[model samples]
Structures are given as C-alpha cells and as structure tokens.
Target: MKIARIETFLVPPRWLFVRVETDAGVVGWGEATCEGRSETVRTAVDQLAELLIGQDPLRIEDHWQVMTKGSFYRGGPILGSAVAGLDQALWDIAGRHFGAPVHQLLGGPVRERIRVYGWVGGDEPDEVAEAIAAQVEAGLTAVKMNASGRMSANGSAAELDGVVRRVAAAREVLGPERDVAVDFHGRFTLATARRAASLLADLHPFFLEEPVVPENSHLIGRIAESTAIPIATGERLYSRQEFLPVLQAGIAVAQPDLSHAGGITEVRKIAALAETFDVQLAPHCPLGPIALAACLQVGFATPNHLIQEQSIGIHYNRGADVLDYVVDTRPLAFVDGSIERLTGPGLGIEVDEAAVRDADRRGHAWRGPIWRHDDGSFAEW
Candidate 1:
C-alpha cells in the first residue's frame, strides 16, 4: 500500500508520536522524540515526509536508506531520531499487513520474556533506600539510579563518599539477588569517574552507565581495566558506526535506545555488532509505550539481550505515564519485573488514537529540567 499522509502529535510529558496512513486505510504508529527537542524532531519528520509520501509502505528498508542516506548531512540525534520514528511506523504497517508481530518478521522471538529495569532515585538521588524498597514492592527486580549530582572537576572526598553511601543504601535494600545499575549520567570527569568507580566497587553495582560522556568513550577501556564492574553506555549514540568503536573499547554492555538509534532497522545491526565483541545489549528506553514495545521486540529476538529499561514511573514523565495512551496496557503487563511476550501484530500494543488526538490538541512543549551547581554553574541534568 502506498503511504498517503504523515501526521505528528506532540503529547504530554515530553513525547512526540507519529502516524503514517496508507492508501489501503492501514495506519501505523511511531514514537519519534528526543525528550526536550520533540518539536525539532517533529520538524525533521515533516521534512523527511517528502521522501515517504506516495512511496510503498512495505519498503521499510528503502525508506530508511533514503530517509537517512538521502540527506548528505545525516545521522545526528535529530535526523536519526526522525528516521527512527518513521521507520518504526513503516515496520508497524508492514507487520499489520502481513498479520504478524514485528518479532516474527525479524526471525521470530528467541525468548518468551525479557527482564526489565525501573528508575529509582531522581536526578539528585535522595531517599534511595525507600525508592528501591518501593520498586521492589512493585515487582521490579532491578532498578537504575543516577550515581551523583553535580560535582567539580576535582570532586571532594566527601562527594565521593556520598556517592558510595547512596549506592550502599540501595545495595542494602536490594540485598544480593536483585540488581542495581548506577548511572553516572555523563556528569563526572575522568578522574572523578575513576575514583567513584573504585570506591563503589565494594557495593557491587550491576553496571556503571556513561561514567563519562560519549566524547570520552576512549577512557572506558581504561576505566574497565581499573574496576571489575561492567561499564555500560551509548544512550546518546545513534548508529552502529557510533557504537562500533565503543564495543571495540571493551565496554561490557551496549545501551542503544531503539528510539534514538534509527529504530529497529539500525538497532538490530547494533545488537549484532555488539554480539561479535561479546558485549551485552541493554537497550536504553525511557520513553513511551511505542518505543518500549520496539525495544522489547528487539530484546526478545536478540540472543545477547540483557535487560530493558522502561519508563513506567520515570521522573521525566509528569501528567502522562507510559501506559496512559495505550489501548491495552495489558500487553505491557510486567510479571516479576519482566514483560511477557507480545502476541499482537505490528509493535504488538495498540495505541489509543483518540487519546493521542486529544492530547495532541492539548500539545506539549516539554523540555528537560535545567540544573545548577552550588556556584550557579550549569550542570548536566
């Protein structure tokens, strides 16, 4: 069927959803957003629509290639994220047309369920013990939290100790059976990251995410050599090419966001590339249901899949949570902290188009929160 029109919805709590309509009346849904820059990605999708309208909806690969390679200046967050959402919508259409789930088209699922992790400890991280306990009570076996707030280039010993203390509390609450992932959030310097890694080793974290920023990925191998803890990064990375070097750096886990890494088309390749280096795949998904469903489809099919991140109660979401816009939140039903197989066609979860349309009319202009240090200097949030 030929694509007839492309529509975008800027929904609540920082999400942009895209809808692709075809000549045969079959429509597909996609989540194409970059958190704060939902409007920018929406514009990018609008520009990319010129390449998709009147094209065959089933030709996902061709559309992806043209949408990506068609532009000489391609592959950053805006372009990749825009292509990502469109690709997801096209894949959804293809799967629905064939009466199969996306996983079946991708060689069927390799597992019945994939373990998922929840977010605990907001940006600054206080009362982590209580947060961990609450998530455990909610049936989550693992929880990820930010490692620290803003720190100087030369962080003090007290700052380092505070980081350890919070982690210690989380470990104490989680005990030994469950996992706790500490995200540095790219807020630490090389020396500070190394020091924190060394200090937190005793707490036995599941992984240290983005110890430094993506630019300092070269230091990951050195950091890995310093500590036994697995180093995980790549939520900021958008393609397999960007991920190849990090995998080569001996990173233990590759956390590519299915929404940001060119959707399923490119992330599947990223997963394969990670597997070659014996690196684990833990997709970074802190978005809505469409993005989460896309990640689960890949997670269920990938052999090296480790854990998936869901944004059910994540701090970024305000009025609208992950399940608010879904027609059947049951497909996302988690049991013992793991989501079972999605048996529906396309991305498996049917979105509430009416809710989406209503929310779109109320359109969001959401942006990430800005943080400042004690001296009023800007800090990553």
Candidate 2:
C-alpha cells in the first residue's frame, strides 16, 4: 500500500506521536518523543514526511536508510528520532498486513516474558526506603533511582557516605534477592564515579547507569575497570557508531532508547553488535506506551536481552500517565515485575487516537530540570 499521509501530534506529559496512513486504509502509530526536544523532533518528522508521502509503506528498511542518510547532516537526536518514529509506524503496518506481531517479523520470540523495572525515588532522591517498599508492594522486583541530585566535582567524604546511605536504604528494603540500580545520570566525574563504584561494591547494585556524560565516554573503560559493578550507558548515544566505543569499554549492559536510537531498525543492529561482545540489552525506555511496546518487541526477539524500563508511575508523567492514552492496558499489564509477550499485531498496543488528539489540543512544554552546585556552578540533572 502506498503511504497517503503522515501526521504528527505533540501530546501531554512530553511525548510526540506519529500516525501514518496508507492508500489501503491501514493506520500505524509510533512515538518519537525525545524527552526535552519533542517539538524539534516533530519538526524533523514534518521534514522527513516529504520523503515518505506517496511511497510504499511496507518498504521500512529502504525508507529508514533514505530518511536517515538522505540528509548530508545526519544522525543526531532530532533526525534519528524522526526516522525512528517513521520506522516504527512502517513496522506497525507491516506486522498488521502480515497478521503477526513485530517480534515475529523479527524472527519470533526468544523469551516467554520480558522482565521490567520501575522507577522509585524522584530526581533528588529522598525517603528511598519507603519508595522501594512501595514498589515492592506493587509486585515490582527491581527498581531504579538517581544516585544523587547534584554532586560536587570532588565530593566530600560526607557526600560519599550519603550516597552509600541511600543505596543502603534501598538494599535494606529490597533485601538480598531483589535488584536496585543506581543511575548516576551523568552527574559524576570519572574520579567520583570510581570512588562511588568502589563504595557501592558492598551494596551489590544491579548496574551503574551513565556514570559520566556521553561526551566523556572515553573514560568509562577506566571506571569499568575500577569496579566489579556493571556499567550501563547509551541512553544519550543515538546510533551503533556512538555505542561501539562504550561497548568496547567493557560495559556489561547496553541501554539504547528505541525512540532516540533510530527505533527498532537501528536498535536491532545495536543489539546484535552488543551480542558479539557478550553484553546484555536492556533498552532505556522512560517514555509512553508505544515506545515501551517497541522496546518489548525487540526484547522478545533478542537473545541477550536483560530487562526493560517502563514509565508507568515514573515522576515524569505528571498530567498523563503511560496507560492514560491507550485503549487496552492489557498489552502493558505487568505481573510480578514482567510482562508476558505481546500477541497483537504491530507494536501490539493500540493507541487511543481520540485521547491523543485531545491532548494535542492542550499540549505540554516539558523540559528537564536544571541544577546547580552550592557555589552556582552548573550541575547535571
């Protein structure tokens, strides 16, 4: 079927949704939300629409190649995220046309259920023990929390002890069996990361995410070598080329966000590349249902998949939650911290176009928080 029209909607709680319609009346939906830059990605999608309108909707890979590399200036967050949404929509159409789920089209299932984690503590984490307990009560086995709000370049011993104390609280609530992952959120320098890693070894964290900013990934190998804890990054890296160096740095897990890393088309390749290095794939998804569903489809087909991150009750969802815009919540239903493989066609979760359009009429201007140190130097948030 020929692609007849492409539409994009900027919805509440910081998300951008794309709808692709074909001459045969098949409609497919995908999310291209880049947390703080949803509007820019929407504009990118508008520009990329010139390439897809009147083209064959089923030619997903061909369109992806052209949409990505057709522009000389290629592969940043805006362009990659735009191509990502279009690719997801095209995959959705293909899966429906073939009467199969996206995972089946990608070589079928590798696991029965994909384990997922929930976010507990907020940005400046406090009352973490209670937060962990509440998530455990909700049938979640693992939870992630920010390590600290704003950290000094060379934090005092008290700051280091405070970090340990927060993790210790989570460990106490989770006990020895469950998992607790600390997300440094690129707020630490290499030295601080090494020190924190050394201190947190006794806590047995599942992984340390984004110890430093993506620009400083060259130093991750040293941090990885300093501690036995698994180092996870790549939420900020958009393509396999950006991920190659970090994988070589001895990171045990690769966390690629499907929305920003060229969607399923490119992340599948990223997963394969990670496989060659014996690293596990735990997609970084803190967005809406479509993005989470896309991540699950890849997780189901990937042999080395570790876990999935969902934004069900994540602090980012202020006005609207992940399930609010979906018609059927069953596709996203979580039981015992894992979701059974989705059996529906396309991304598997149907989008509520009515709710989406309504929310678009009252769109949100969501931006990430900015923090500063005690002396007014800029801090990562």
Candidate 3:
C-alpha cells in the first residue's frame, strides 16, 4: 500500500510522535522525539513528507536512504531524528503488513526476554539509597543514576568524594547481586573523567555513560583503557560514521538512541559495526512509549544486545508518563527485571490516537535544563 498521509504530534513531556497512514486502511506510529528539539525535528519530518507521500510504505530501507542522504547537508540530529521517526513508522507498517514483529523481520528472536534497566535519582542525585531501594522494590534488578550535577572543568576532592559516595550508596542498596550504572552526562572534562574513572574502579559499575561529551569522544578510548568499567556513549551521535571512532576506541558498549540515531535501519547497522569490535548495544531511550517500543524490537533481534533503558518513572516524565498515550501497557510490563519478547505485529504496542491528538492540541514546548557554573561559564546539563 502507498503512504496516504504523514502527521506529527508534539505531545507533552518532551516527545514527538509520527503517524503514517496508508491508503489500504493500515496505519503505523513512530516516535521522533529529540528531547529539547521536537519542533525542529517536526519541521524536518514535514520536509521529508514531500518525498514520502505516495511511496510504497514497505520500502523502508529505500525511504530511509533518501530521507537521510537526499540532501547534501544531512545526518545531524534534526534530519537523522526526522528520518528516524519515519523509518520506525515504515517498519511498523511493514510488520503489520507482514503479520510479524519487527525483530522477526530482522532475523527472528535471539533472546526470550530483554533485560531492562530503570533510572534512579534525577539530573543531580539525592537520597540515592532510598531511590535505589524504591526501584528494587518495584522489581528492577538494575538501575542507573547521574554521577554528579554540573561539574567543574577540574572537580574538587569533595565533589569527587560525593560522586563516589552516591555510587557507593547505590551499590550498597543493590548489593553484589544487582547492577548499577552511572551517567556522567558529558559534564566532565577528559582529565576530570579520567580521575573519576580511577576513583570509580573499586565499585565495579556496570558502565560509565558519556564520561566526556561527544565532541571529545576521541578521548573515550583512553578512559576505557585506564579503567576496567565498561564505557558507554552515543546518545548524541546520529549515524554509523559518528559511532565508528568510539567503537574503535574500545568502548565496551554503544548506547545509540533508536530515536536519535537513524531509527531501526541505521541502529541495526550500528549494532553490526559494534559487533565487529565486540561492543555491546544498550539503546539510549528515555523518551515515550513509541521510542521504548522501538528500542525493545531492536534489543530482541540484536545478538550483542546488553540491556534496554526505559522511561517508566524517569524524572523527566512529570506531566505524562511512558504508558499515558498507549492503549495497552501489558507489552511494556517489566517482570523480573526483564520484558518478554513481543509476539504482536509491528512495534508490538498500540498508540492511543485519541490521547495523542488531545495532547497535541495542548502541545508542550519543553526544553532540557541549561546550567552555568559559579563563574558564569556554561555548564553541561
């Protein structure tokens, strides 16, 4: 069937959803949320609609190539994210048309259930022991927390101790049985990250996320070599080319966001590239239902998949939670710290069109926090 219409919704809680309708009464949904840049991605999607209308909905790969490479100035967050949502919608349509889940189309199930990690604490951690306990009580076996709020170019010993203390608290609650990961959020410089990594060595963290910013990703391999803890990054990276250097840097995990990194088509290729380097995949998904569902589909199919990150009760979902716009939450239900392989067609979750439309009418202009150090210089947040 041919694509009849493509619509985008800027829903609450910093998410952008795409709805693609085919002429033969089939519809597909995808998420194109770029966190703080929803409107820009929406514009990019509108531009892509010029090429998408009347095309075969099942030609996912072809559409992806054109949407991504059709323009000379391509492959940034805007275009990549726009192409990402459309690609997800096209994949959803293909799955529905073929009567199988997206993972099956990729190659069939490699795992029975995907282990997922929950987020504990906020941008700046507090009462982390209690937060870890609460997540464990809620049936999560692994949880991740921010390492520090906004760090200085060169952090003080007290700040370093606080970072270690928070991780220590989480480890104490999780004990030796469960897993705890820390996210630096690209707030640390290379020197600072190296020092922090040295300090965190004793805790045996599952991974250290974005220890340095994407711009300074070349230094990641050094950090990885200095510490035994697995290094994970790529939430800001949008293509396979951007991920190549990091993978070669001996990064233990590649955390490409299915929503930001060219959706399923590109991320599948990214997974393959990481496989050559023996790097594991843990998709970065802290958005809404559509993004999380897309992540699960990839996780089920990918062989080297490590774990999935979901936004069930994440700090960002203040106004609307992950399950708010979904008709069925059963597929997303986390049991025993893992999500069972989805048997349903497409992305394996239904989008509540009514709720989406209602929320779009009262659209949100959400933005991520901007921080400044005491000296008035910009700080990463």
Using lDDT as the measure, which candidate wins?
A: 3
Task: Compose the digit string of candidate 1's lDDT tens values, residues 192-250.
Answer: 99999999888899999999889888777888878899999999999989998888888
lDDT of 2 by residue, 63-94 (tens): 98999889888888888889888889999999
Per-candidate Cα lDDT values, in order, are 0.90, 0.91, 0.92
TM-score of each: 0.98, 0.99, 0.99
Compared with the true structure, model 1 gives a TM-score of: 0.98
As for candidate 3, its clashing pairs are: none
lDDT score, candidate 1: 0.90
Clashes of each: 0, 0, 0
Q: How accurate is candidate 2 locally (lDDT)?
A: 0.91
Q: In candidate 3, what residue range of length 10 has the lowest lDDT sum?
A: 121-130
RMSD of each: 1.1, 0.9, 0.8
